[model samples]
Target: MFISVVIPTYNRKPILEKCLKALEKQEFNDDIIRNYEVVLVDDGSTDGTLEWLEKNKEKFTHVSCFSQNHLGPAAARNLGVTKANGDIIIFIDSDLVVTETFLQCHADALIKGEKKLGSDRLFTYGAVINTCNFDDPTSEPYKITDFSAAYFATGNVAIARKWLEKAGLFDTRFQLYGWEDLELGVRLKQLDLKLIKCPEAVGYHWHPPFNLGQIPNLIDKEIQRGRMGVLFYEKHPTFEVRLMIQMTLLHRILWGILSLGGILNERTLAPILQWLINQGKPQLALEIARIFLNWYNVQGVYSAYRDMVKN
Candidate 1:
């Protein structure tokens, strides 16, 4: 099958160049795979991603660029899928630098899964290793925190285009920050689609090292994720959805105690977090910051749920 590696990018030109380069170097020539195209949908980036792509057009031989207003990733991905010319759709983020055999691994796994399951009702989920090493993202080793139990995430996953269309693409109303991908996963689950883990299709997800400077944006993202999570629950309205959104009493109490009832917030924990950063432990600092971050999410989820109830 022809493959489309669809990536929805925001203002991430530097890593995006790396992402495209890696995809261009893929070694995919299996019987199940024909050829691949990189469908890059820019979500109205201010960082001149399009211009950079134009300048380095010769570098990326397999990329087809598209753009839309800053309508968030859901809309961007929808546009990418619509414009794609492949039967197999591989969803990955622009910051994820993949290995040369990434596509091959996914293709092999898909074929094996179909044969074993007696049907093509399956998708392949790849491993995502988070890293702060921009110079060589793939050099970073996997950590426990990188272990995700998510059934489906847009980070590194491949599925047939027909399944996505049948399940209905992401809800554009999740215009905030998160849960658009997993919401679609829920629908795919209802269609009896199984997830086959493909660990060989590794992608290193790169982000900047944690610092006090990033606290505001990070917190804002959690809140936005919470709001969008409420939209996810509204669409499904199941106990599992509530648990996933952290909208339940257990999550509320857990985060409340962990954050010391919201008193251990960014301002109060600044010294500790800064100390951890100064000690060259940004990862630990980020983990500590998650205390208040999770509190904000639980609060935001409940607040949105309350607003929905009132309306």
Candidate 2:
């Protein structure tokens, strides 16, 4: 069987190098995975990503790069899926550097799962360990915060091409920062797709260490995520979707209280965050920053919801 590792990239050329390098080192049995390709879709990256990849084409033997306009991951991923030649499609982010056993683990899990379930009606989900260690992301161990119960996140998931086409791929309406993959998950669930957990397959998700300088961009992403969350709920207007989008009073009250009614904003917490960073606890600082970040999300969700109602 052949596999296609589909990755959508924006302006993330630095870690994309590591990601492609790691993918080139994958080892697997010929029978399990006869061949594999990396379908990398460059979503209008301004950082010369496509040019660099082209220049280093000889280095990334398995990589096939494509370019598109500044559309979101949903569109980029759809283009990748539509153009992929492999029957099995594994979705991962551009910043994710995976283990050598990543493809083999997914293949093994898929084979066993299909046999046990008596059908090819399932997809394999792998573990994603988040880290700030740019030099060596995989060196970081799994933490409680890294545990994800998401049904169909794209961080590390492998599925048959047929099911994704049937489910209509990703909704391009999700052109914002979040909820695109999960929205596709809702559609895949409607098609009765099963989730097979593959713990053996791991991917190290790389992100820069948190600092006070990043607060603005992080906050903007949270707000954008909030806007996209409402779009997700609109597509699937169910209680579960509402909960996922944080359109509930519980979320509102929780974030509000934790943020002290928006008083503990980035401005107010900048000193403490910088101090923690100086103390070499940027992760903790990020956690504390989440207090206000989540508040911005809740407010953005409600504001977008209100605007939707008005329109």
Candidate 3:
């Protein structure tokens, strides 16, 4: 059971270094996982990522590097899948640093699941603990905010290569910030693929602590996610998709009430958010900022949907 860990990275060289190091340290049974390779697809990063990887190739012996123009993760991941030589594919973000037992845990889960289900008609979803501790991301304990209900997110997951091909891979049209993975999950669900939860296989997703300076980038990401949500709905046009994208009246009313119809935006919340940051409560500030962020997403999705309809 050779494994190809497909990682799509942009300008995340710092954390990507940690991610690759952790993968290099994975402890797995040779019988269970004959060999594993990290298929890293750099999406045209101008940050000397390629040069560094090339220079440090001796250190990352298990890594095979690929590169593309700045085509976003969807396309980068597709390229990885195409280039992968392993029958089993594990998808993880470049920012996620994992335990040494990560690959072993996923392999054990897959073996058990295949035995129980009488076939390999499933994928393993690993736990992702969000951490702002860049210095030691893997040391952070899991928090409620880190919990995810996503069936098939790329942050940490492993699937049989054939299943992904059967599901037709990810839609590159979701070229924006979100929903590309979940959109593919919808199709994989239709193919009767099961999600085997592997809590033992954990990855610590590292990001810099939120601050007042990040509000604009955060808002822009929300807007991009919203636009991609519309594209997701166009392809899957179901009530489930509508709910997932928060395109329904329920989301509109909920975000509207929470944000007071956009009055509680980044501009209005800057003072309070900055205060929280100063008080060493960046996470709290980020959560509070979500009120307006969600509103922006709701509005952005609706606006995109309207534009799509008009055209």
Q: Specify the highest-lDDT model's number.
A: 1
For 1-311, candidate 1 gives per-residue lDDT tens digits of 89999999999999998999999888856566788899999999998999999999999989999999999999999999999999999999999999999999999999999999999999999999999999999999989999999998999999999999999898899899999999999999999999999999999999999999999999999999999999999999999999999999999899999989999999999999999999999999999999999999999998898899999
Query: What is the per-residue lDDT of model 3 for residues 1-311, given as tens digits with 9 covering 90 to 100?
Result: 98999999999999999999999998866589888899999999999999999999999999999999999999999999999999999999999999999999999999999999998899999999999998989889989888888988999999999999999998887778999999999999999989999999999999899988888998899999999999999998999899998999999999999999999999998999999999999999999999999999998999999999999
* Stretches of model 1 off by over 4 angstroms after superposition: none
lDDT string for model 2 (1-311, tens) is 88999999999999999999999999876588989999999999999998899899999998999999999999999999988999999999999999998999999999999999999999999999999999989999999999898999999999999999999999998898999999999999999999999989999999999998898998899889989998998889999998888899999999989889999999999999999999999999999999999999999999999988899
* Arranged by lDDT, best first: 1, 2, 3
**All-Cα superposition RMSD per candidate:** 0.8, 0.9, 0.8
* Cα distance off (Å), candidate 3, residue 188: 0.4
What lDDT does model 2 reach? 0.94
Number of the candidate with higher lDDT, 1 or 3: 1
Q: What shift in Å separates residue 308 of candidate 1 from its native position after superposition?
A: 0.5
User: What TM-score, to 2 decimals, does candidate 2 have?
Assistant: 0.98
